[model samples]
Target: MLNTQIKYIDYISKVNDEIEKTNLPDKVIEKFQLKETIEAIEKVELLVPVIGAFSAGKSSLLNSFLGDKKLPEKITPETALATELRYSEDEHIEAVGANSDITTFSIDDIEEIKDRAKDFKYLRMYLKNENIKNIEPLILVDMPGFESPLDLHNQAIMEYINRGVHYIVLSSVEDGTITKSMRRQLENIQAYERGFSFFLSKTNLKPKEEVEEIKQQVQDQLEDYFDITNEIGLVDDNGGESLQRVLSKIDPEQLIKTIFLEDLKDNYFSIKEAINTSISASGKTKEENNRAIQQLQKALDETLQKKNNLIEETKSRYSDIRINAIVEAVSMDLSNSIEEIVSVGMSGDSNALSETILEIAKSSLIVNVKDSMNDISGEIVNDFSTGLSNLNSVMADFTISENWIAGIAETTKKMITGASNKLNTIVSERKKVQNNNEDIDKTYKAVTSVLAITTEVVNPIVEVAIVFLPEILSFVFAAIQENKQKEKIRTTILTTTIPSLKRNLRAKLPEMFNAQVNELISQIGEQFEEAIENKQASIENAQKEREEENRNMEQIIQTYKKADKAITTLANNTLYKE
Candidate 1:
């Protein structure tokens, strides 16, 4: 029943009130980055990516929504890419490159854009049209049809499904029903647990009676295919209903669950875990408390030692594995492009050769090194998972690493009495559904933030390879003879250029990888430290109360109980349920 993102903001505000109950200086709110999470929730926009089969008028439908032939395409763009239409007073297109480079294009540079389409990651077109402004947070992604060529286009679609709250899929009315290709796309959407609407475009090209029959047949097929009885929103381009109007009908609670829910639940569980730890530590005698504190201190000490070892291991991994992979990939790819490299080498354009080598290095890094970093990230989590076992049950286990697996396991034993009871009521239904549907792709807080920063591991490593090019390849072009030049050029590249690239990479890359790995582990380990400190704070606070004979332990315990009850009731509401 919650119809706006305001419900989520209000929910967070209420949770903050509970977080304030404990007198710990560093609260659960700061540990989980809830303030930033709320801001991201407020700025959440529903991306409606429209996909369909060839000539399904996917682009036409979106440009029509603009009420102008704004997006230039032959119904669908020729390339396997997306053109994202967003609202901005200052209108322009930013061509995002695979290497995260941006090139700005004029709003009217349609031909120029088409010429350079293959070079772009996606085109982010900012528009100031009235209808676009009216939709507010709903941005439309114009996607390629089912039969589009190239792997990057498919990758783009796959990435979009992760962030898209829902999809608006279209097929032509003339086709009369869904095609096999479209059915596959819908299956994929279902696999990702995303909801989509069906729109039959170009209805004006068919008879009204025939359009009605096709719409009905498509609706029935979708229900039968997806094995669900929920009615899909079907619209036509001939004007009976508008796409914007149907998009407005999207259930806001579903949107919240899809976009902001994982982050919200993260903070919820984090606070619950902290409270439980405090309660568990409450009844311990002074000697028991000292023993526990000593144990905690021992773990913290072990963490510092582990961090130094991990940093050293990260440096070795990059030098041994990541750098070697790049060297081999760049060398192997260039070996095949001997003729092209020879051309650039003979033309005396050291800059062209540098550019060619840089492209190959970038490709190699994206395909190879990025994944290796994720593996290292997984190792970091697994290494610390055991050491921080007491505090991680609710928070650390689920901390974001692309390759790590998160499971609730037996860590629920850490919860205190009342919080455990409340968790039981929600876990049987709500948690299971959310984990199955939405939490599969989630990355928790600073872990993900650090990863985002480290994803640029490619640029510094590969771009650094460029500087060595001019220095190393400068000698090959000094003397050119037609008879021996080609072989000399190839040998020089395979011998001199590549080794220089590898040497410089090995020299500079381990440090880069170390910094990233350190930041990631530290970000995760800092949370562990805070949780330990909060528990210690709770134990000490209770001691002070007993010494003064003024503080009521039952009252403090009741505050936590009340917080658990409120959180449980909120989870039981319609927004958190399936």
Candidate 2:
């Protein structure tokens, strides 16, 4: 997997270098970058960094993994640094800096030692656990709160992530969804490294129902935005209650293990299959058999080009029919909605009148827009279907004469084999004379013998093949002529029809709507904007209400944070206890 990632990285780097020279599209470059990142992650061993907003129970989740309450103080109770846990027999914890300076500290003294100068840039503690020993070696790095007020603290965590294996994103239920800053950090990590997971921490802090709702919402949002289909794990401090619910949905440890093992197995099998196929194909002599293959490849390319031209021609012919249908549908819907709105406004009902008027206008605009879109979609589908049908018809005419080609290929093979055998026989007959370094006359005779056989055996076969060449040449010319005619028809239709249809559809709709439709559209636009502004005001009011709710929720956040800190502190103290 690592090898594959390295190859992918190198390939992408070379491609990017070329793209820079060529000034390729930004979207193409971005696509390459995304592919490179995903490939890189597939190779590296990832350490899931459980990160979140300050006091979001990131430490508590780490404690749960360790199966101990003794981790380290979270938030202000402990130095704002990342602490990683891995299996080790040694009783000491090692703190290493980005500068490569190492500091040894008793885990118990971590909280008491307030010397910021001596504080390590990164900390790793070895815990004596049978479970850790049995699983693939992984160190869980507990990141400081991503949104920590202290820049140095955040920078320290960021540095740790740059050097670390993978990330496990964490968030709290009461804290709302993961913040935008946290997401940006994750994106930054993804830019360089591939390994990361998301964890909704402190599920126990909220009710099961609320936690589930938050989890679904967060998962849906992440999947929609990041295109990640993996189940997002949720962590709870209380005996893994909510964590287990998430675990039931997705086992993080199992997933991590599978990431490497399954990928390695898949790559190994693929390489093996490729090697076997190459060896099997190589048995056929290139000199004897490749000419026919080349001819077939060339024929296929020509056929494809012809098919493409036919497809384009058909698309041009049918495109307008589909676009007109959709445009008519949209115009009708918009006109009806506008008429209804005008009728309602004429009635002069003022109570809820403003809301109703705005709603009607917005609805009319949406219907009209959707109808236009529908027409475009219908045109696209019709074009695609017509194109495919025409391509099939062209392909049908370009019949691949496999049997005739195969016979010629086999004849060429026989000629090469016969010549080779005659040469071998002559070489064998001259061996004794050549070995003695004597009998110059015999050696000359042997050389002449092989040359004569080659001229006689190979030349006649070539001559025979050459005789048939005129027929093949005639056919190739005929095919080229047919292809040219097809191209001319294709170009004529596309140039004359498709663009005109699009323009016509665009023009017909406004005419169909007339002056009343125009007035209604203008009214709808104004009402829709007014509705949006009203919605924004309502949302602001809701936000105020949410802030009040958060005041009540702050206690829960604090409770979870305290519980997390207590558990981590206990675990750290226990592990380092003399």
Candidate 3:
């Protein structure tokens, strides 16, 4: 995967080189900002945000998961800026200003840090915590309680929305409902490309039955009011098994995996679009190269006919075979990868699964498409280079924009890396689930759900990325002009013949490629969804079997009186005082 990333970076460098050679108008280059987008591929990180209203036990919940009172808990509606906690060798903090300057601070300066956060964009806390050791290379942001300071909430949303950041929406069970403001936050968070999980905080304060009722109510509210269908997990205020259960639901590794692939796919298509725009917008003259243009048209007509015939023949003979091959290969790959990870997770050893899935992500269709760009470029160049020496200069110039091939390659590499990081977070968080069969059951459900969601989110985008630039033939003809061809036979080719060729290739190639990719994605998605269903069914069957056994044991053991307490434990009482 890392090798692919390096190759991808190299590909981007090459594309930049091509862009420079083309000397595209400054406005076009600036409009696309292809260079900046290419550079962003490496810097992308999955933002896992924790957000909720004040006095909702948000800080307590995060502190419990980290096994330390890291975040400052407040009783009143004291405004706080967004704060990101990441792993570090030495504990420290940095305030990142809106203008991009950083101010470092010692860990002891709590008041100073708070003051800085008020004026700063966000504060980055570097902590060495054993609880989150497995989730290294993670950025867990704790934003100001939603609705605390309106501007801070908006700023947080605007700043991190596009950076592949998913959210953990925290709502207190004390209210037993979703508020209007909270619904608005949910709407905003769901608008991004990333997925989100709902966290019902202070679940321990209510009876188990009451807690379950609250969850149902919230889920129904989500469906009725917002039409959302996200999983909501219980976060015990006392930080026990319930807390672990909630943590298990928001798998960081899975988030990273999904977001990376998503971004990579987006980046690849954007580059293709930019290259196409640049080519279409290039300057052309009709009268100056009329003779050469006529010869070019005749040649292009002959060449396009041959190409079209070849595509049709291939489509007739090999289309089904290619589709089956792709579906079979990807299904086997995804099945093996998912099964292996599920097996490990069910065994209470999810840590080893990240590397395995990362390997699988490396071989996804988008990555494969990116990897194939160079060969595809070479093939197009070879196919067009045949039977004409007069058009070689033009063909060569057309091939220069093939630099976008590298850009595509680079995007896929980043996709895998991002997914790998998120997978790491999932595994790391899973470690908090103790080595018990009960926790293992929870692990199974969590891993299965994450895998299913990942498949659903990633499959369509891969299809799009693979088919984004179906035929490079359009850009290939834009550069074939000779200043010295006074009156060549192909001069008309530039105006009439080449445009027709472009239309034929555009019309045919995309249809063929799209059909193949759509079939591949559809087959894979079905197989994956079926696999998830089967696994879920098996787990349910096993649980039923266990319940039957437990019932028999309960009858044998005889009934005992259960203690009923008059006073309930308050969530705030157990929170770390700090």
lDDT of each: 0.61, 0.42, 0.47
Off by over 4 Å in 1: 1-3, 14-21, 27-29, 75-80, 230-240, 261-266, 279-283, 294-578
Off by over 4 Å in 3: 1-39, 131-133, 240-578
Quote model 1's TM-score: 0.57
32 Cα displacement, candidate 3 (Å): 12
User: Please, what is the TM-score per model?
Assistant: 0.57, 0.36, 0.43
Q: What overall lDDT, based on C-alpha atoms, would model 2 receive against the true structure?
A: 0.42
lDDT of 1 by residue, 1-578 (tens): 23546777777777677667765335334555555556666656667788877678776677677888887657334554687888889999888887768999889987787777778768788998888777667778888765554234444564475557688888888787876446656765664456887777887787888888887898889888987554545455632246877777876556656555654665566566666655555555666666666666776677677766766666565446766675577667667666767776777765556655655554555545545655655556556666566543332222332211132211211221011121122222333456768554222322333223333465566556645666876656564444437778878777877777767767777677667666666655554555455555555655554455667777876776777778767755624665
Q: In candidate 3, residue 378 scores what lDDT? A: 34
Q: What is the lDDT of residue 509 in candidate 1?
A: 70
